[model samples]
Target chain A: MKILVCISNVPDTTTKVKFTDNNTKFDANGVQWVINPWDELALTRALELKDNAANGITAVSVIHVGNASSEPTIRKALAIGADDAYRVNAEPTDAYNVAGQISEIVKSEKFDIVFCGIESSDFNGSTVGSMVAEFLDYPSVSAVSGLNIENGQTVITREIDGGKEVVSVPAPFVAIVQKGIAKEPRIAAMRGIMQARTKAIKVSEPVAIDSLTEIVTFELPQPRAKCKMVDAENPKQLIELLMNEAKVI
Target chain B: MSVLVFTENWDGKFKKSSFELASYATKVAEMLGTTATAVSIGNVDDSELKSLGNYGVKKVMCVKNDSLNVHDSQTYTKVIAEAAQKEGAKVIIIANNNTGKALAPRLSVRLKAAIGSGVNKLPLSVNPFVVVKRAYSGNAYAQVALKSDIKIITLAQNSFELIETPNDAAVEAFAPSIDASMVKTQLKDVQKQSGKILITDAEIVVSGGRGMKSADNWAPLSELANLLGAATACSRPVSDEGWRPHDEHTGQTGKIIAPNLYIAIGISGATQHIAGVSSSKFIVAINSDKDAPIFEAAQYGIVGDAAKVLPQLVEAVKELKGK
Candidate 1:
């Protein structure tokens, strides 16, 4: 079985987010970049499925919808054991455009399943997966916590408000993995890092989309008020403070 | 110029966030000098739908259908898009829950509107169309401008303050012309994990991390959760160990929740873990490491051992409840 994992380059979660130049765009200076945490789950799950395949999964390929600046991220995905990588040579301006490009790629590759994070840590929109699925006319499930592949069908467990739902879909579906499905993302080993450089990195152009979502400005959240500490060894005092001072109760 | 809200319901009961989103939509409608109407689908009774009027809704369009109860995304999108068009709603609001997150994008395509998810604040500019949205998974804020004639926005769970004032309104039963093809995917079964309340709807949540020592000790935490009528969650490490189901994992990778009271025990708040629970109204942290990053996020913190704190907190809750 062939799998396509979509990865996005996002600012590391630890970065203190800020905006510059009248807050029109995110400030790029002094920011460390990493593959989105949820995307790492998708990638790792893709690898696991490949390793556990009975008929022998051919390869796991990583794809990113971004410009040349995102090469390192695509390379990192390869180093983490993707057999090859593809970088769409375009800046992702909107989720529709991103999905359009992936749909075009999906048309050619005919991958058995596509994997993506529930949402990018940066955009946090959680749209691209479903959009891609809709564009391809394939079944899609989001926030999958458990996955099982058997008898040419995949069973996935997802959460709703009061309970859980376990759904099954045939192969050639799309799954957006959330966190908690896998342990810490495996780090690229020395041998895998060396092998990644030799793997093929394909580039593709984005398809045309007339409409797009726009970002007007980006800003840091208002600083939280300073924490008010209470005296320890006195539970009643803390309760009093919560009732009288904070007035939350 | 009317505003539309999708009332989230599960098993024929409206979720609290639905009323909260309706309250928010009411304000947005008032800001635009128009009325807000709600569109809901489920097996909900009309009398229950009438209660939505108290949230300042002028009317409630109840789409009572059995297929709607399971939250079929494709069918929902078709129905909601038609409702928006029929009502001539310029702005649509929905809770940023799992269903809303799945439906908003599809509705955007059908309505030809620019969509924004995880919206936290009111529009900065209504004319040019800007709303502040949570970025970097709530670590930062971004103002998104939807340069379109129609707009759809998903309000972040627990972001807006809810208000209550009575309004005399009518509940109108509306039937949507849903295509059979839209209901292509069928729900086989719903397998819910048995434990505390579902995290998204919980008023109080008690979460732990790797510091709980072993999975066997989870009983006390569950006991405390039951006492408070709270939900039980875990950091990534606990879920990784299979001590808890991944669905109950609250962190950057798991479900993002915003309960009224979040009591985190033995967990050092990693940025990833905090990403999911940052919107909780009040946070209480209990950890041995005083300098754990979780302290930075908590409103009230206790420096102690979980082994000692768990039973004590359970007892405290039980005493308070007289149970």
Candidate 2:
């Protein structure tokens, strides 16, 4: 089975977020980027699917929709055992454009299964995978915690409000993964890292898609005010302060 | 002008977040001087869809298709886009759960609409449109304006009140064209974790941290949460240590939650941790340490070991419920 996993390069979770150019864009200086946490789930699942297949799964291709700065992330994904990699040579500015680029590529390849993280940790938009599936006119599922594929069919389980729901669909679908989908992702091994150097890294120019939205300015979120701690012995004191000072109750 | 809302359903029933979206769409309709209509998705019966009229939906459209039994984001977007266009909808509202998050962006592209996700309130208009949204993992809010004619907004979970009406609404069946070839990814098998309420839509949450000491001692927390019909959650340290699943982690780098009531047991609220549940309406902290940071955010705090305080509080609630 041919599987395509879409990944994004994001700042490490511990990095303190900061914006540059007068707070109009995210500052990329002196920041270590890692494969987004959600994307890791997708990659791990794809690798697992490949491992269990008898015909020796053809390839687990990794695709990143970003500019030159994202190359290191794509390389890291390769080191983690993706068969090959592709970097769409463009700076993704909006969701529409991102989805359009993925759709343009998929029109030719026709991957049997496409997987992405539930949402990106940085933008947290959670829209691109679904948009890509919609643009491609393919089936899609989101925030799936568990998945299995057999006999040209896939079964997925996801959480709902009070409980869980199990759903089934045929192959050539899109699935966005979340936690509990698999065990903590395995770290890249030495052999995998060495083999990634010889693997193909395909570069593709993004197709032109109409851009309908733009971010005028990206500003830092307001800092929270200093916290006021009340003595724990007296619950009444805290309630009084909440009603009078915070006025939340 | 009329607004179109997508009521996401699972297992022949509507999701709670969909109800919150229903209430929010109604208020938006009230502002725009129009009525709100709902399109219920999934394997939902007409009767359950009609009951949504209590939340200000005047009409509910159920799309009955066997192919739609499982949520294919592509199919749902196509169907909802057609419904909105057919009804000449000015605004489209959906819940910002996993499905809505994926559906809205795609729908925006399909319908040529301006899209906003994680919205916390109705639009503020003054010759233009602006929506309030939670950003920076709920530590702050942003007001964004749209310049597009067609507008799509996804309401944040538990952000709006669920309003009820005295009468039932009307229901209608709609047919959606499907491209059988569009079905690509097939679902395989599901592993269900035994639990009470799913964390995302829970109104009340009971969470624990490293204070619980061991994984085997989680029964008390589950027992307490079961009593309140609450969802169970944990801090990052607990989840990182494999005491609980990562989905249950609540912190800045974890799942952000805003429930009506939050009970923190034996937790010292780190900055990352507080960023997640700071929006909770009422907070109750129980810790042995008098200076635990959780006390600062809690509405009511008790300086006692959680092992002792939890049982007492559970008994108190059980008595209050006459159980």
Candidate 3:
């Protein structure tokens, strides 16, 4: 069984977000690109499943839809333990277009399972996984926190409004995972890094798909007001201010 | 053409989010010079369905299918798509909650419509179909223009206010053809955490971080949360350290919450942590360091050790509430 984990190249979590070109584009200058945090966790969980011989997982592969600049981030996934990688050479304009590219890859590779992070930290569209499932007519389980292959059957656990539900989905399904899928993202070992240098990263041309949404502009959130300080000696005064001035208590 | 709103009910009862969706859809319909129609699934009461009229829905299409009683996203998408086609809806609106997140993308694929997910406002231009949504984890906003005849939007939770524009809404039963093949996933078991306010559903949140010192020091924070009837949350480091459950962690990689009031106790507010909570209406920070990054995002700050301050704040709230 092969698992295809979708990877997204995103700015480091600590980079201060900015916009350029009259706020029509994200300012990429001085930004450190990394694997999206959620995707990293998903890759870690996929590798963990592959490590256990009981699961009979043959390979864990990673795929991304982006330009050449994103190849480094894709290499990081391989270093962490993806057996191979696929880079759909194109700019991910929107979720629909990206999902289209991924669906094409899934069809060609016939991966038994596909894993996608619930949402990427950059756009936070939260749509590609389900869209890919629809494109492939495959079963999808969203908000998945736990997944295991038991007796050759895939068992999944997902979060609902106020509870958690255990589910069972057939093969060739998509799992939109969030946090708790793994304890922590696995770091690349020196040996894995060396091996990744020789791993094949097949660059494929993207299928033709028109992006449905266009970004007109971008704007930064309003700056917060100066904080009103309350002395530690008079903690009650803070409550009074909350009740009267802030009216949020 | 009408604006279609998908309203979700919890065991025959409607929640604030449904009303908010109805209100938002109605306003969008008005902007388009059309009426708003709502489609409700599962076993909702007639009176409950009628209550949507208070939020300006002109009609309600109730789908009483037991197979859809449990939310299968594929089946729900099919049902909603059928309804949208029946009504000839030019625009569709749903809440950007868990269910909507799962359903919208599939619906978009099935209906051949463009989606603007997690939009916080009404369209800036109806003709061009431009909507604004928070991007980059609320650090920036994007003005997205949808280029499709039918547009689907998932409204951000707590972004729109509930407006009461009472109308005598007509209720009609809708039965779309659902097949067994559409039920792709089966729910095996469910576990609910009872008698505790979930952080996502809470109006106020009191969050702790490493500055709380240790797991033993969480008592005062929990006590303050109980006193304010708020939920308890933690930073990622706290959850990673096993001081709190993973579900209690709120950050970019964790649960993203937008409560009315968020109190940060001993958190220094990394950019990722702020991303999850920057949407809160008001933030209060209590930390020993006056220059903690959390203060820059907080409206109120108390520069003191959480150990010395949390108990006093709890007492003050109790005294104010006469508890």
Best by TM-score: 3
State the weakest 10-residue window (summed lDDT) of model 2 chain B.
B182-191
Q: Estimate, for each residue in B179-215, the C-alpha lDDT of model 1 and write its tens digit.
A: 5555645567886555446787787888988889888
DockQ-based class of model 3: high
lDDT per residue, candidate 3, B81-200, as tens digits?
A: 999999999999998988999999998888878999989889999989999988999899999999989999999887888899999999999999997667878878988888889888
Tell me the docking grade of candidate 2: acceptable
Docking class of 1: medium
- Candidate 2: segments with Cα more than 4 A from true spot: A20-23, A53-55, A151-153, A216-249, B9-16, B42-55, B64-70, B126-128, B139-147, B163-171, B177-195, B223-229, B236-255, B268-278, B282-304, B315-323
Q: Worst ten-residue run, lDDT, model 1 chain B? A: B179-188
By lDDT, is 1 or 2 better? 1
Residue B259 lDDT in model 2? 88
DockQ values per model: 0.51, 0.26, 0.82
Query: Per DockQ, what order, best first?
Result: 3, 1, 2
What would the per-residue lDDT of candidate 2 be over residues B1-323, giving only the tens digit for each residue?
A: 68999987767887677778888888888888888999976678777888788798998888888777655677678889989987889899988876787689779878877777777778876237677666545434555666578888888788888887535778888877776565443444344655557777788899999888878878888887887778899998899899988778987656778888788888898877886897787777777887887877776667777676666666655655455
TM-score of chain B of 3: 0.97
Ranking by TM-score: 3, 1, 2
